[model samples]
Target: MKLQTALRLIYPPRCVSCGDLVESDFGLCGPCWRETPFIEGLACDTCGVPLPGHSDQIEHCDDCMRIARPWSRGRAVLTYKDNGRKLVLALKHSDRLDIIRPAGVWLARAARPILQDQMLIAPIPLHWSRLLKRRFNQSALLAQELGRLTALSVCPDLLVRPKRTESLEGKGHDARFTTLDRAINAHPKRKHRMAGRHVLLIDDVMTSGATMAAAAEACLSAGAHDVSALSLARVAKDA
Candidate 1:
């Protein structure tokens, strides 16, 4: 307790969602924590998209029904706008290690019920140049936390982004999906490890579900029996 107090005195903690100083190191201030929607209620079971006035028994969303995902099922912690983008950007550029703990915990809480029986965790890897520039992979940080929570093995290098592509920054749906269609590949050595296993792919965000879908296809081609995604946030159309 004394050491913790001294540490706080030296460097007070801050909210993960906001930059306000916190009294403790638990990751977020009271109001900001409460404001973060944990994405509950009736969500799309297949892709984790929020549905309006959905019934619990409905097993799929219109998107999932019309177009099938290569993965088995997925979970997303937030609706991928507002504070969600802030959190992802904080970690991506600001070197916010503190956000990882709470974000991971929240992600674990969201994923636990669905992922209780999953076999392994695989974070989508960044391209070499981007990895060097960023000095970290946000997905890997989230994956490590999920691993710690669920006791699942984290394979940080199971999937790789073989080439750097144009950022999906201003791209429309068609362009974004097409960009990711060939962005991912499996590591040769890891291919054997994925056989017959249910792999959980982790990412900071899922926009258009294109990247995760491509990663899932790679996993399937590499011999994973089943694949699923768990993201911190997901982008959606204006409702």
Candidate 2:
């Protein structure tokens, strides 16, 4: 404990985005904090899209109406815009472990309703081929850290991306969905872990809800009682 305090005195906390010195632990500086596009209120119940109105009665957006999502509900901490996008990119490609704690804290607070006694947290998996190239899976990192925060059972191997699919970055909604349709599944041997359990899936971002829908469907087929999803950011795009 004494050594930890001395280390802290030597190295104070810095902003996650800009690396600017800050007073608090695992936080952003004032400017970056203001710049982050947090999705605070009135988001879609199904896909986490930000709703325009202040009314509480509205639940889902148009996309959710046209689409069939397997997950019962979804939650996101911020919009995939500006600083939020930058942070996600940094975490995904730059090995920015510095942001993991603060980001996981925000996701945990947002996912409170999804966390329950029977809940098991799992991440959307990447195929072994892709995993070898990337050297890490951002979703698994988020889920593991979230498990640490909530004391929930985190089974990162519960799901498997057995087949490698091309990057969905520039793909359209339907195209992405097509690519992910059967790409994800519950691990053959670990199916028992998902059976009769409520799963709270974690990911760094939700773009078309395609990935989450595919993952949730896999869990449900494996006998999961229910499935919901949480993410750090949600893509806001026109349907």
- Which structure among the candidates has the greatest lDDT? 2
Candidate 1, run of 10 with poorest lDDT: 110-119
Which lDDT tens digits does candidate 1 get at residues 1-239? 99988888887887767768987675777887777666887777778877778584856777789876898788788877777777778888999877888888888887865784657899988999999999999999899988998889989999989889889988987898889987999998899889989999999988777888889999999989889888998776642
Q: What is the TM-score of each candidate against the true structure?
A: 0.92, 0.95
Per-residue lDDT of model 2, residues 1-239, tens digit only? 99989988899788898989998888989999999988878888877788887875758889999898888888899899899999999998898977888988999988875578868999999899888888999999899999999999999999999888998989999899999999999999999998888999999999988999899999999999999999999988742
Model 1 CA lDDT for position 185: 95
For model 1, the stretches where C-alpha displacement exceeds 4 angstroms are 21-23
What's the alpha carbon RMSD for model 2? 1.6
Top TM-score model: 2
Query: Which RMSD values do the candidates have, in order?
Result: 1.8, 1.6
Worst 10 residues of 2 by lDDT: 110-119
Query: lDDT score of model 1?
Result: 0.84
